[model samples]
Target chain A: MATSADHAAPAILNEVNPPELPRAVLVENNRSFTWITDKICGIIEGKTPAWWWVCFIVACFVASFTVAGITYLVATGVGVWGHANPVNWAWDIVNFVFWIGIGHAGTLISAILCLLRQKWRTSINRAAEAMTIFAVVCAGIFPVFHVGRVWFAWYLFPIPNSNYVWQNFRSPLEWDVFAVSTYGTVSVLFWYVGLIPDLATLRDRFMAAGNKLRATIYGFFAMGWRGSNRHWSNYEMAYLILAGISTPLVLSVHTIVSFDFAVSLIPGWHTTIFPPYFVAGAIFSGFGMVLTLMLPLRAIYKLEDLITQYHIDCMCKITLATGTMVGYAYAMEFFIAWYGANPYEGFAFINRAFGPYAWAYWTMITCNVITPQFFWFKKVRQNTALVWILSIFVNVGMWFERFVIIVTSLARDFLPSSWGYYSPSIVEIFTFFGTFGVFSVLFLLFIRFLPIMPMAELKAVTPQADVHGGENHH
Target chain B: MAAQPHGLIATFETAPEVYHAAEKVRDAGYKFWDCITPFPIHGLDKAMGVKRSNVPKFSLTGGIIGFCTGMSMIWFMNAFDYPLVVGGKPYFSPMFAFPVSYELTILFCAFATIGGMFFLNRLPMHYHPVLKHDTIHRGMDDQFFIVIETRDPKFDAARTRALLEKAGGKDIKELEA
Candidate 1:
């Protein structure tokens, strides 16, 4: 039997120029197998950080405004939102699209990256998936109340009822109910299925420390996972199938959401480019949100070894790519509008860039198009503070993109008399801020209670944990 | 069958060593044996002589049902129940039905996969004999283990321990049922 050293010498010598494998480290500083579990599980087991409590409390306080705003809106009616004759789909719809777009990154990381065999996603996928679930929740809240009678939201589903009034199958609104709900349900199951092994790890850790209650709680979720080969076989297969299912589902979700506008006869809204354009924008905003959350998290948790520079760099590249795609879509929308020679469509394009809401149009251009181009330089991508700040710019820019799309198109339609400037009421502004609070509270609790990083998955990617090969001494 | 007093547990430092031992145990004709590890060690199923999972088949079945349901619901609601033309398009257009059908297919498939996993694993069985073993905790950490049940036909305690030790297993123990 040839020793590994003996085999390595010939392979190294045989190649004319062995491609220099990209020097990026997946897990930095050669972390040990036990170190992976300890560092990750330690976050859950160890004392709560003071900053976490501060963030959580602040998030909850801000989230209270959402409750108050919703209460007032329900009491006073949708008229409180500044929705008038033409600009009726202001702030609420824009926020809905923005949040739903934010969720795409999570599914993109977990399902799409998993299928593509991108090992780096293992570090961030769990948290990203959790973010998807919470973001969808925030997104779902808007359209439900946008109907004015929130209680009658159940009518959105195609249930057999005594009223005998069936939902329009051709309506994009009906498709949205299915798309958003299905996306939410699948995201949760994927997150939980991935969490089971790590939950078992937590169960054992808590049990060892004589914390019976915590053990019981974790154990219940773990579903008595004994790591049997039989169970693992099914688990892996199920995970793969889910990844397969979710990849297209994620794309479809945003596409269906896009159809809510694109299917309409409105000049700016009706375009063939909306699906790909929306999907790219969704990924762009999603990565921005990931960067916003992860940069601070990596600093706070001191998880530089696990969530390394390479992960951040890869994410930056993705943001750049998706941002470029979004920019292309923006350009294409204008180009097609002009080339098609339709006066309403051509006017819509001109109005967007130079009309009443031109400020928002330019903001979207600066933040989404211009800011991310800075990432083409390695220096900008590697700079954590710059990346984090730029991510916030992308977030703001994406919100504006939706704003420009919804309000500008509606504010000035076919009839000149209905044309009016629209601005969000205080209630609408508060509700939007409140969603940020809702997302933060869920995220803070998630980081505190659950294994934020998938401990088992992180371990699987390390050299020492490889099953086929012997441990790499390096 | 009555609960056994003890079953043999063998611990290995690495996944490959335990995987080999699992293969050895399977080749030795042990029926009631299983391996445990911190994570799912790749190719462990082949080593344990386990068959491929049928979860995908169940998912497909679910997807077919969902497709049928989606098509039927849309057609019945729009065309048959009470047709109301808004855009002068066909009431039961397949193109219009595609989105709802796609969503339902994914929804049903996801539910089926999860359900199949749970059913196959006989899960939510909170109490297991292996859970009681002291060294079982390490299975969730860094250690790899193979346990042969007392209920197995070839379960002579002394011989089973000797076989495990020969296969490079460490810290072999008699776990109480």
Candidate 2:
């Protein structure tokens, strides 16, 4: 338990381009390496708090709603949803898109940030990546169940079957199946690979503490990792390649998701701008979610030093940048509709903002557009309370954005006979709400059983880790 | 009877100590040696004379197979195996096949990358003489360690220990894994 100050030997001055520019210490308080390990591992090894029990219990209860809703849907059929002739997509599609969009932020932090060399991502990437996996899990439920029969959802894959029915390669829905599944699988590999070093540390700690059961479990996964440099040589390359592939993969996933609409004939959904717009919106909402989840956990764990306000500021700025892009996309959509002179298309955009679903459209505009603008002010970004509340708005707005796009177009299709207002059935509402519970339950378990932060990765960022760094090289 | 003396291990307090120690070991002509640390110390690979990993080769091979699989799978199914038409379009078009191919490429590439890493690292080894060292866990924590194996041609108990001591390594110990 030696303090960092024990060997202070004047802080190592990092070499910079301008020679002596200052940078924020990624880990605050000059915390020692042992402190970092003890702090992170403490969460899992320490007694499970009462509040965790309450939260876990509630999450399970909430998750049951999904289980119940799916069971009923299977028994009664897809008719249990409020989907009708024209608005067949309805909340199922909306909720699916919503959950999928949330998954992007995790990959963005892990892959995109790693590629960009954003060092601060180390503190939050583990949790964000976990969120990505669980969000995808929640997202997978909607489309699978919406296919009218959950059992036949396997049909989405290109596996051989008795009927020899192949998926329609031409259909965007088919592309979505490939894109999402690939995204989910790669994300798990990336997440698990990142966990190995930290897992080995936990295994060693458990063994030292005489917790053979936990140690054996963690050790099996650690794969006899002794932190050997030879192993690290390959491990680092694998990580870099994963990040490289994932960067393109994350962008492609949402673009393909957007293709589900853009490739369609629906006026609002069919836009050349959907790809970049959807990607931007996904990043925007994803950062909002990262903020939402991190703020609470940071507070609860007292991880202020690791998370730091600098990280918060950086996150807020990205949200602002992406949020602005989304707003621009919204405006451009209208401009394209007007400028193109397609009456149906023009009518669709006009109907979206001024039609029956105007409430949802306006709500989206306020939450997605106006909410992020607050981040422009340093006051807002720095205020944890304000940032948390606004992060919720960002997610709410993104959900509505999907809903507005789906519902408004279908609610007033080309024929008046087919036109009808869309609303969710109680089952649909609960099913969508239940996903949050499902996500929370998985996330809670992850925190309880695993290292929520990448300890080894974080240690790498500290100045002390630099061999040529600091005055005390010895 | 003495557990066959697997190798000599030495502890260093910091990355710099290990980095320099690795250089000394490399210069001293040890081949079956490695530096174990809590994390990858930047530039330690160069110090240890380690080359870039060959994981990308496996990743590329997997990607190529995946792409061919996606392309041929669709061509065989829609164009050859079943032979049906839906949207009055050609039976096979790479334009439409690109997404699935691209996804499969990434999927298989990832699988290969992870699999290659594990295969190359000889992981899940479960037992190693190094793990027998009571204080070896420290290598996965804050401390840095250099272990020159008994298998190394240059390995000699007295000489290796002296070389490590000269490189600023402390608490040098000889143990069998």
Candidate 3:
């Protein structure tokens, strides 16, 4: 072995001629980890005027007001918002299912995509995982808060109680408790485990004493990793196993969540196809949110090189695939309703398209189905501006998708005598805003504290990190 | 940053250098040193004669424990403790237990694997004999170096230095705490 002082030029270093890096890119100006890390920290803080702090500040305000609205709703009751005679659980259920469904894309990106050996996942998996956690937290708030007796929420879970009332295992709501809790727990674990190595890198590089401390803490959780072959072997295996676990979870969680609506005897709501349809829709919306979040951050952070057009292109493909599936599901549901020869089901389908919420129905079709077709074009998919706009449309479309499923089906149920129109009150609107606030605040905090990209995973795939030769996708 | 005399410490610029040097060192009848590299160099483990890990055995045991635990827990929860007729369904139906049981099997297997790995590797203590070695920190980046334990039978400070020098060691130093 060569001694430290007598070292040969490393293969990675020798491959590239010392390209003249821009002076403005402080990280490029230095080769040492110490210098590069300090620059990263500087970029994170307002030390450099390069950041769009104005947008972040405005986002913070929007998030805070959302919190205020939530507090107001919680202080009052569900009655403060919506929920009349027939449409008692409209926006709340829709939002709950919608957010939960959106969360699936994160775990799917991080775990399932990783298992499938999709290298592009490394670019956005961290952010997606963070989104998953935040989205679950958002999803959880609605269910608990919607119950009104938020304090007695534990009744959902089975416990040894004085009242011999055994929680019904047959109930889909009970299954939801198990599924959502498990999803949240495992996703958090997966996210944190994935973060360990990146945190250590951040710790080793940054000058901040707090960062150093955090890095140390993260290092401890990182299991004193030295990138040993022994460690990597097990770590890679564990990641594989986690991804395997999460793939089914991504499928099962939303299926069970959809069962919450489907288990009911309601006309349009109760359908055999709801499980698969909802799962597809969830992944679609979740990917849309991922793209929405990634595009802005990639621009703001100047991480275009790291995030690349390739990642957006891949994510757009998934969005299109899922969008088509959802559209197919829409057509299938209507066909099934017509074919079933059930009058109530047929009428429910008819009402959804031509009834009071027809605008919402058309919006869903346009945003989720019609607009996403543009993504099939390579040029349109590569265009960040177009992708961002499409992502926003997908989100709105999916929300209306949930709204149509929940409110439209319930408003005119089995009998026309009990049919009624449901509209969200100011409180419901405020509470919805508040949930966004909570989600945004959590996401902001996550970005500031954690590496938005999995540095270690990226390093594994980067050309410099490879020991055994493979073709570089870049 | 100065080498303390006991045996030779050499740092290679790249992984290939370390591999080449390992073959040379083995041929030269030096068997006392350890190689440190930024990332895994294939075949190094065989060259180093490190034993096969026992983590799998521990993981297998953990998995068995998990499988039984999952079955028993469900049996206890649904069958023994609270035997309520759910949906005209039979109590302790194994089919319904698939999801939770599947989850537990994975959870336990993972726990056991990690736990066994840690126990076998002697990790999380932040103290190691190798930390005292010079150039060890550089192993995280683009360097590949080996520290021959001076206490080994074939180790002689001077002889080791001569052999390493002849083997194209870039920077040879006697590392000490």
Q: Each model's number of backbone clashes?
A: 0, 5, 11
- Residue-level lDDT tens digits of model 2 in A1-474: 367767564445333324655777799998888989999999999999999999999999999999989989999999999998888898888988898899999999999999999999999999999999999999999999999988888888878999977778888899999999999999999999999999999999999999999999999998888999999999999999999999999999999999999998988888999999999999999999999999999999999999999999999999999999999999999999999999999999999999998999999999999999999999888899999999999999999999998899999968777799888899998898888899999999999999999999999999889888665444
Query: DockQ for each of the predicted structures, in order?
Result: 0.78, 0.81, 0.22
Q: Taking the tens digit of each residue's C-alpha lDDT, what string does model 1 give over A91-176?
A: 99999999999999999999999999899999999999999999999998899999999888888988877788899989999999
Candidate 1, chain A: TM-score? 0.95
Deviation in Å, model 2, residue A311 alpha carbon? 0.3
lDDT of 1 at A399: 98
lDDT of 3 by residue, A1-474 (tens): 557645676677667767766312111222343322333344444443424456466667776765776677678766776789998888888889889988999998988888887878887898999999999998897888778867778887667677756565556777787788878877887787676555544443432344566556656665665545555455555556667767877788888888888888999988999999999999999999998898988887777766777777789999999999999999999999999999999999999999999999999999989988999899998789989999999999999999999999999998789999999988777767767767877887777766677655554455433334444323
What's the distance in Å from true for residue A158, model 2?
A: 1.8
Clashing pairs in 2: A12-A470, A12-A471, B6-B176, B129-B177, B130-B177
Summing lDDT over every window of 10 consecutive residues in candidate 2 chain A, give the lowest-scoring window. A9-18
Q: What tens digits encode model 1's per-residue C-alpha lDDT throughout B52-75?
A: 999999889888888888999899
User: What DockQ class does candidate 3 belong to?
Assistant: incorrect
User: What residue runs in model 3 are displaced by over 4 Å at the alpha carbon?
Assistant: A1-57, A206-223, A468-474, B1-10, B15-75, B85-92, B100-121, B129-177
Cα error, residue A254 of model 1, in Å, equals 0.6
| Candidate 2 residue lDDT tens string, B1-177 | 556688999999998889988999999888999898999888899999999999999999988999998899888888888877887989999999899899999999999999999999998788887787888778788999999999999988899899999999999998766
